[model samples]
Target: MPVNYTEDAFNGLIIDTNTIPTDSVEFGASLTNILAYSAENNKGITWLTLPIEKSHHVGRATALGFIYHCCQAHELTLVHKNQPAQFVPFIPSHTVGAGALIKNSAGEILVVQEYGMTGYKLPGGHVEQGERIEDAVLREVLEETGIKCEFVSVLGFSNKHPYKFGKSNLYFICELRPLHNHIQILDTQEILDARWISLADFQRDAKNSAYNHELFSALFNLSGLQPQALENNKGAHKKLEIFFANHKDGLL
Candidate 1:
């Protein structure tokens, strides 16, 4: 009886081809000859068969080579296929999040420590469906910190690590001013603690926590703090520079 190849079987055969040594010319020639013979015998394959496979492999190799070259040229750490990239789209999940940087009269920045999360982050939360990002930020801030805020300017954006929460993108850096008189913080399930700290204090806590270093750095740069302060704080400034640099390339 003739060998029968199902779709899955054919796919497995193709995968098996990957293990073939690239340096073996005889192996390549033998595989090519066998594929040609199989196509001729099967009569199901057409003129496009060999060309299509060749094209696909060539294109894939070319793409991979280009990526490798770019990473080498830029001195970037190359991620393998199995090692997922940061901020990549995961399974479909609805996640609309936003954050704000609020400065008080005493030059303190507003930050909140969530009950479950490890780090102290800025006040923000998921943007509900049919809600604008600005509105979401406003609502989240009020709900978390018990302070109404007026939107000022946009700082930047960031994305969550891939393979987590369906690869959500978190919109960070919307400047805001307080509006309410009584700073009566409402203790909610989402937030455990809230407080305004000096920029230095915020930086210290952020460094200690597993917070997004790049995002915080971008926030500091956008704040336009004193040059002396920024220079004195090398870690903060370095993080900011890296964030801004990544942000620029992402835009392009």
Candidate 2:
């Protein structure tokens, strides 16, 4: 009997594919239907994740050929993930991280470059258990930059998908004002160098790579600091222009 499938239900189709006998004819038909219906109906599933069933030597590689065919024949963008690179006996869930967005009196943004990494990053680290997000941000900033700073306001956080190590990270960005203006590495164990960069320079570096581009964009969006912080907010970085008739701080 040909398997019946719901119009747009994943469990009704994909999930059932796993339990079906791989040696049986139903397996091929089910997988074919999944690819065909996904291509035609725009099911919008990017990852065609099939269970790692070792019973019949079923692997993601087996599906790759069909996925390639789906792209060539039906013009679909699909990939598969199963039997991870290295099977971890056990792994943890998403991690919570906190970073600070601080500017110097000269309006330079603070960034840190790790030992083995290219380009600079905001001062941040994983939030330990029982630590408040605000506290974590302050601790990480001080540890990485060795600059004591006072928290101004809660900026926001970035939620990243699992890219490497099967671990996603939630990074909280907070507005901080430096109490002490000095760059000393308190945590040499983690960070190699720390420096303050001009906002313009930071923006260019962020947009340089796809990873940094998305990261910085997410940071600005999460912070909601300024309307001009979005991805389209390009062009030469301009100085602040406070327009007021009477209220003049005389500081740009």
Candidate 3:
């Protein structure tokens, strides 16, 4: 029997895994029927999502030409093109990270030395799923170094290809204002040391990357991008944060 399915906006069919049989032989037969039915009905593509419990059926689906698409903690998604002319949607291909560039009135920058890594670098980490960029930076900074800060502007961003797990990485350079001067180590495991270093000392250090040097050198003239409030704060755009070019204030 053909498996239960639903047509998505792109006319692709999303198979209902709950409706599939537990037995591999039965699933193979049902999937074959579904593919035939989809082709006959001119469907665009077929999405097969199998839970961890139905892992046995993965081989059966692959034998019928389903390619690996993406997966989650407890499930896997496979896709097969039914319509030769239709295009498959691109999966998320980049991980977002944020680095905080916090400067105090003493002209010292807050830097941290991560475990297994040499030299001091800006404290940051990967942005969690459904997390705001500003919030992620603030959280990482506070977690790595016990310091409260307010978001300033996005100084710049760097992109590195073939990063962790073969996904591209987007590292945003965020300028922040320190709320307090006290420095305490919070994430003792990941961070080795957290302290304030003068701008002159940071620039003289050979351990710092050229990108970091340029950012600091051009700091006085760069205004960076600042997040602006949206006029239409409803529906899909409500939670979205838009960064606009900063004109009035400079970083220095």
Candidate 4:
């Protein structure tokens, strides 16, 4: 079953330490209140959206470190809203990734075996800084598997649930038009293998599949995608119109 989570799921405790004026006493007090609230309320997670002042003189980093330490001590879940991508120096952190659903001429889906991952997964990876979502999808695909592809419409997104993903990861789900027939694993150190796999084969080996089976199941069913129709790549080259439905229809 999909984890039914939403923003409202939490008794949102927005800990904004930025409002504290440039006073040492005030800063210390704010920090104390944050830790106390979290320690007292063993439930709600803390969403930190503090100011970005890393200067040693300003002591913003030190304040941020205290927030971090408090969460660690209380075993409280933390959401670094100020630093969604961690592209900046240091505020808190969140990762953004892009992935593609690439189907081949045989209609088989493309999957890659990662060095640390089990079974197989869609050919995609972390989006580089300043990279567009579509570009990131194509770039990651080519980097992992030397297979060029054309951009198709996106198939919504799978927001990484903190419980499953550990941190907040907004992953884009894109439909890609493959240009090459052969897949060449370029990054041998990071990638184990890349190849086409049939839906039947994927389903049959679900027992031995990766830990992301629930995610794939949610992807296909939520997107209203038909695996049975595109199971075989026996026809001429044609553009596939991917069907999409909001995966967060009910969960979000």
Which candidate has the highest lDDT of all?
A: 3
Best by TM-score: 3
Candidate 2 residue runs with Cα over 4 Å from true position: 1-92, 163-168, 204-252
Kindly list the per-residue Cα lDDT of model 3 for residues 49-146, writing each as its tens digit.
Answer: 89999988889999998988888889898998875555564456888899988889988889998776667788888787678899999999999999
Off by over 4 Å in 1: 1-94, 161-167, 180-182, 206-214, 221-252
Alpha-carbon local distance difference test for all models? 0.52, 0.58, 0.83, 0.59
How many pairs collide in each candidate, listed in order? 0, 0, 0, 2
Candidate 4 C-alpha lDDT tens digits along 57-170: 134434554234223322333342232333221223456777888777787888888766557888887766556677788888998999999876566666765722255777
| Clash pairs, model 2 backbone | none
Worst 10 residues of 4 by lDDT: 1-10
Residue-level lDDT of model 1, residues 1-252, one tens digit each, is: 121222221111222333433343443444455345544544221111122223334333323321221112212221112122312222234455778888887777778887656667788866666566667788888888989988655676666755232255565567788875345567565577788777676666644364544455557646421111134546633432122222344431
lDDT-based ranking: 3, 4, 2, 1
Q: Decide which is better by TM-score, 3 or 4.
A: 3
- The candidate with the higher TM-score, 2 or 3, is 3
TM-score of every model? Answer: 0.47, 0.47, 0.61, 0.50
Query: RMSD of model 3, in Å?
Result: 13.8
